[model samples]
Target: MIHFFKQDVSHIALPEKFTYPFHYTPHPLCVLATGEVKEYIAGKKEWQEELATGKMFGVLVVQMPQSTDTGYLAAFSGNLAGKNIHSFFVPPVYDLLQPQGFFKIEEEQISAINQRIDELENSASYLKAKERQKVETAKAQATLNQAKAGLKAAKEARELRRQSSLALSEEEQAGLIRESQYQKAEYKRLEKEWKRQVEELEAEVTRFESEIERMKMERKERSAALQERLFEQFRMLNAKGEVKDLCTIFEETVHKLPPGGAGECALPKLLQYAYFHQLKPLAMAEFWWGDSPKNEVRHHGYYYPSCKGKCEPILQHMLQGLEVDDNPLLDNLHKDTKLEIVFEDEWLLVVNKPAGMLSVPGKADEVDSVYHHLKKLYPNATGPMIVHRLDMATSGLLLVAKTKEVHQHLQEQFEKRSIRKRYVALLDGSLSDIEKTGRISLPLCLNPLDRPRQMVSEEYGKEAITDYQIISVSNGHTRIAFFPLTGRTHQLRMHAAHPKGLGCPIAGDELYGKKAGRLYLHAEYIEFRHPIYGDIICIQKEAEF
Candidate 1:
């Protein structure tokens, strides 16, 4: 699967360390290799339409041992064109799709179980038994009801006869009471008989269902066991030649079990082959080559980091014993940015937060944040000084409270949605068909696999609404104003990039759009009530871009 480099690259310097897979700037060699792979895919017109649906491909630049030959390996996530054994791309760690593999053999048995379940569910005998049970139960209930009604009428008649007999003789009254007692005894007998009939009918139905239930239980157990065994077969390799299966690797992580499709990603396949063949890996990169997914924001040919949920633990094991670059997330992104105070009073202040600055202290031993800055400025400020937050990539106006009481009041206003916010952003693409004004109501939730990234999810997302007005369209870019009625994380970004909404990503939005000098979104205006003064207040800041 090694394709030797055709272009001369002797002048380019090699990286001092391996590219960190989780987050990276693609190396020059990797970029060259990715371009070649893309060219090959493009020439294959047979796969063009299917591949236009979207796929992830990766390249691993490796050095052949004791030789000057420098070639790269290519891999695609999962299978291409329904097969994992395609030429040029590396094979999977364990080909579960192989016809003779244990996974397939077990899968057939599971399929049989499923078929049997369907047969039993639709069997004539089972259906007939169910129908009979329903009908018989209804008949039994109706009989009991009719008997009770007859007994009630008989009692009424007995009472009338006794009342008339009171003027005649005591024996007559005694006879009427005896008749009432006999009628009650008959109703009791009929009720018991009907209950017995209903029980028999229910038992008949249970007899037909018992086998199907047992088969379903067996299917569940066998499927779970088969999946665990499949994980065991996927043994991974590290640069040191150490090995760990999927189960063992995931057990060491916070998620104690491997997620589905854990070992099939392009990153894992590339490294697995590199280690298996004794090649020394120097650099790697993964890029999306086709259509962007519905929920995520992806640009064609743009390089992206490996996912966290599936690849993080696997990469942690596979990358051992190699000199890798430190994670960039731990570094401060806005060390030179300074917070600008926009408005201030006895209780609170509004500051213009620069893009890339954190609203509060973050993990990875980062202590520089707006909250910490306020602490240094006020020194004696009480409670949490930071009243609200903005995405690190977004420049915005943030409210800061000086006292605990004031913070509570501001929080209450936010909860009641009395605080109004307006943002201005420049989209990377022009929206020729978009109306001048509109409302976008796409729901959003954090992508479980990728932290801090939001996705459009109608099923589990919280309601996020934005009203937008197109400001101007110029040079293939659209500038718009966003009035957010909800403050979910990344709500505005998701609404803008999602295909069902604006279908355009904001300029320089590294997570959703092409990376540039900075994100082109800004909180330009806000209106709120003063917490202490009980007076309406408004603030405005012009975007630098």
Candidate 2:
């Protein structure tokens, strides 16, 4: 259910007409609401009346089950299903004290007032009894004094009679006895009054005994609440439960601190918890959670700096299957081409690829390509590695390493620009200078709209270099020997298609230059240090163009 009951409409105001292009938009107070409303749009009839009368009401539109902040119902609308709902309506702000958070607080105050009234009534009765006991004490003291005086007189009379030595009268002796009895009775009454006073004091103490117990319990509960708040703050900072030494810290330090009227105790615990969690050092006593209160990581001075920026995701995806053992190319190569094992050794294998075949499986499904074909050809190889890639449309020499150690050695050579690779490609342009070579240095990056295509970018691009020499010009096309200094995706196509360079696209490159049935570019040569032989090995293939 959507909880929209606590919200108020006065806090939300509609913009002046013509300020907003849209007739209605989401209301801001949807977060503080209680009732669920399905398909409730903003700008309702009630909202228009409230806005016109310059009054606000608590209103919200909520999604059911989730109570999501999907939209908000406001008090303004131009029309309803069939009537102009905004025409005959007036907002009543003061008359309507709809049940809200303030209502709850007022109810709590009323309850407290009623409790205070009961306490006052009980206190008044107790005070009246105390006053009555004081009056009784005064009366009892006066009576006891009178009785003592009378007893003194009777004792004197009896002494006089004994001195006279004449036969003492029985009636006089009896009188003395009676006076003695009266004194005794008065003393008893006084004792009774004193006892009554003691009983009344005890009764009064019993009345307040529960108050003392309540105060003690309240202190205990406040202490527990303070600890809980601290623990919650600690969890927020650490992003996990049970920080180290936290329980001991609360036991030794938090418990000893005074709770200033129950509420102040949570502050110290919160501060100390932040200190222990490394969000703020113990030396810093004060800290703010910041405008974004949910971000404890920021408050604790932690940051995650982006490494590769936009390219990071793409690179991560490329490396996902880099370490996997499966090689799909072996199982899905085109039927027209078959792999030819050129040379084999303990740690390496060389293969000759046919034209119209990929060096590795495409990212799409369907493998059985050259890399997997090599793996299947030598099932005992530790980890088949492609030292270089031959474009699917171009084919020639391809190298693979059997072990990771050998693969790294060859990869490092390629990275350091120590390995030499040469390719021959037929271009659509004729060359005026024979055996003339030139270098093309340009930055390369992927085209934004068509990411599969590469583009030349002077800004925010990687530097690429290529060298080319004219081989033969015949049939309005020039065959050239190409050497690349930097390996980049589609670097050769870019170099050959440049206006100042060959000015002719690779023969079969439909993406760059004149389209043909097949690409003429071939992997003609590769030279690198042998992993086991400790010798400089150079492999070459005849020019395909």
Candidate 3:
């Protein structure tokens, strides 16, 4: 059985139930473990050295049944020598240090093969061959140029002879003609020879390229086979002594092969250790500790949910008989609200959208959206009525086109940036005097591991700009008005949350800030020219909050 770390937690309030593994606030045990790990790392000289390199470390709080108390185990996602070897933490999912392991051998062999291929590509003989081809091409071009010059000279000579034919003998004229014919024949012969040489040189280069391609394909095949062997060795076992390889588990559950970083999480390591030791699983949580990655938002000492893309499928199989909470985010919350139409015309309609309703039908079958509701209300609507979309948590004025032509026109306006919009949000914290009015220029991209979550990442993100001014400030919160210059997924939420932008997330943003009753963002105003009417139309709706 796993041993629990002894600490005075008499005042700490333990959660009565486990957190929904998909998303929830971290349990008290997990938070305590995070604090302990932070303290431990700060005191260690080796850990300080490792932290300087920006390595990510994670901790998992688990309950061991045999110990009659909840304990925590820590592990790095990839590797950290000082942390991994610590007795207080669980062992790695796979120890890569074993010198005679098949993984190590396959890795070394593949590395050697890649090195050999690189050497062959840059060898002296290969470079010399390329230079020789270049020299031959230059010589052929020179010969072609000479042939053209000779042809031109022969034509000029023939023309002069023809003009002087009356003053010259027939023999001289015939000789001149013969010389011209000879030059033409020589030019044709030179052209043919040049073509032949060029073709031969091209064929030689093709052969060299083909040989290199063949070598690469051969190496790829070997590497693929080795990788398959490595994956097959990653077989996991359950408490019942039944075993299944990681590939089979993912395929049977998610109907696809396991993706990269599938079995490299803290949960897999902790669960595997529990199964082997016959310890009943009680609760588990994972937290991020270290520098945030360049492309993802991860603050040190923050608790994060397990990734959906990589871990969900694996955990579905691993936690076969264990009871878990249904994901609350998947529930349809738009059933009660009716579509509020603000304005209607022959060509278009503008409606007030409610928060918690989808802009369109999502992947889930039970989802109720503004588009689907409009289809029911206007059964004879000619085209896709929803011209644009607001985030599910944002309430606002939405434009709808009745005909395909009107839809196209409005879409064109949006693309041209002629349509104007304004949003209102209550931020969690106050802004300084200079920050009362400003624009935020930050790039954003989706966090693949956690769906719908946007992070500030300049390297791989799209440009998202937001203009804002303080509307009011009271009770440790500031109500701000926003003008979005560019549209991107979760642009406002991320901009509000990013430290470089506002340094405070919009209130009730579960992904970036603390969770509340609902997100405090509302699209309050919109203005655009009518497609058929040629008159400008403006609409406004007040937020219920």
Candidate 4:
């Protein structure tokens, strides 16, 4: 059974509702740890320099037993030096910093090899070889130019002979033609020689490059050998002294390659420390303690989930012997709630989607979706029933087509920008009148390492535009209406939270902002042309707060 520690009955206030610990405010213990980290940073001159440049620090709250009372210990995630060294916090699940570790030795050797490769590229022999090729190319060009000149002169002579038909004999004209032929042959000969010389030079350059690549490959093999040894050494021990290395754990469980940043989170650190010290594991929470990263949204003090790509597999193996709580976020809160069908016809159907229900089935276990329910209700429904989708946390109007023909027609309308959609949202911060109404044009794409989470990426993202107007502002929150022009994933959420756009996340946005009861984003209005009736169809729904 999962275990939770009982807080001391001393009038110490705790959150009345259970905050999803994975992505929530720092626990009091974690806050105290942050204070300690702050003091530690202030005392060290080196840490001050890193702090000035901006860095994200985190603290994990764990429970330990004491004679008088249950005590709490706060473990910082990673190191303050940003070098990821072993610290007061739990050692990394994989000790990449072990003295004389294969990883360390190979990493240094690789650096030296890279330096040698760079030097080879800039060496006198390499430079001279390149220079020789250049000179050969120039000589080839000069020879080709001379041949072309001779050919041109011969052509001119032939033209002069043809024009002087009355002055020159047939033999003389034939002789001129012969001379032109000879010049053409000489040009061909020179061209062939130039080609041969260039090919030989290219072959020489290829040989030189091949030799360099071979050397680099040899060094890389050495590095790979060391990495294999290091991976073998990455073993973790639990409180019961049962040990499992990373390679075995990953191979047996995830059956995939370990992702970057694996074994580099607060959970691994906290768990390792708890097991080593024989502390009884209790409630745990991790919270950000410093500046937000430029590329990602990380509010200072906001709790975040351990990254799924990296930590999911590792945590799965590490938490095998521990009694852990089921992730509250995965619970389907809207399982009992039915899809509210607002409008339906022979050709199409429209429904008012709830905040927590998915537009369609996702994972195999996630069979509760509007599309799945609708398919069961209308078994004859053809093609894709879901014409468009709203985010799982976003509530409101959704379009559904009953037939393939109807779906195609509606999809065409969407592609042509003929369908209109308006959303209502509550922003976390107030906006001035000038900032109240404007178009937010930001590009968005998925954060590759973190799936499903979208970020504003200028270079790699698709265009996402939203025209917004503030409806009302009270108690530091702005109620805004959004008219989206482009249908990109998470366009409205990212636009609302991006610094260049509104600079405030929609109220209750868990991924882009702090978590609340529900995401305030609601699809309040939609308009499109009916496929069969040929009349314009409009739908609107009010948000339930």
RMSD of 1: 2.1
What lDDT is reached at residue 520 by model 3?
Answer: 94
lDDT of 2 by residue, 143-191 (tens): 6677667767877876887788677688876876787777678778767
Cα deviation at 533, candidate 2, in Å, is 2.0
Flag regions of model 3 displaced more than 4 Å: 1-19, 49-61, 66-68, 81-86, 163-181, 184-215, 237-242, 249-257, 338-352, 372-382, 401-408, 427-450, 453-464, 469-479, 497-505, 542-545
Residues 1-545, model 3: lDDT tens digits: 24455687656765555456777766666666777777777787766656654544555555565565666666656566633345756776666546788867877887887887788788787777777778988998898898898789778877877896677778877888788788878888888988888788778777777777887887799877765665566667654567777778776653466666566677777777777766666566666656655555555555567777777766766676555555666778777678889889888998888878888888885888998888888888888889999888778889999888999999999989899999999998776555678999999888766676777777888988899988998888989999998889988888787767776778887666666788999988889999987899998888887
Q: Which candidate is the best by TM-score?
A: 1
Candidate 1 local lDDT, 357-406, one digit each (tens): 77888885464678877887899999988888998778989989999999
For each candidate in the order shown, give its overall lDDT on alpha carbons: 0.88, 0.51, 0.75, 0.73
Q: How many backbone clashes does candidate 3 have?
A: 0
* 400-484 per-residue lDDT for model 4 (tens digits): 9999999999999999999999999999988865565789998888887666778778799888889998999889999999999
Weakest ten-residue segment in model 1 by summed lDDT: 328-337
Listed in order, each prediction's TM-score against the native is 0.94, 0.39, 0.81, 0.83
Among these predicted structures, which one has the highest lDDT? Answer: 1
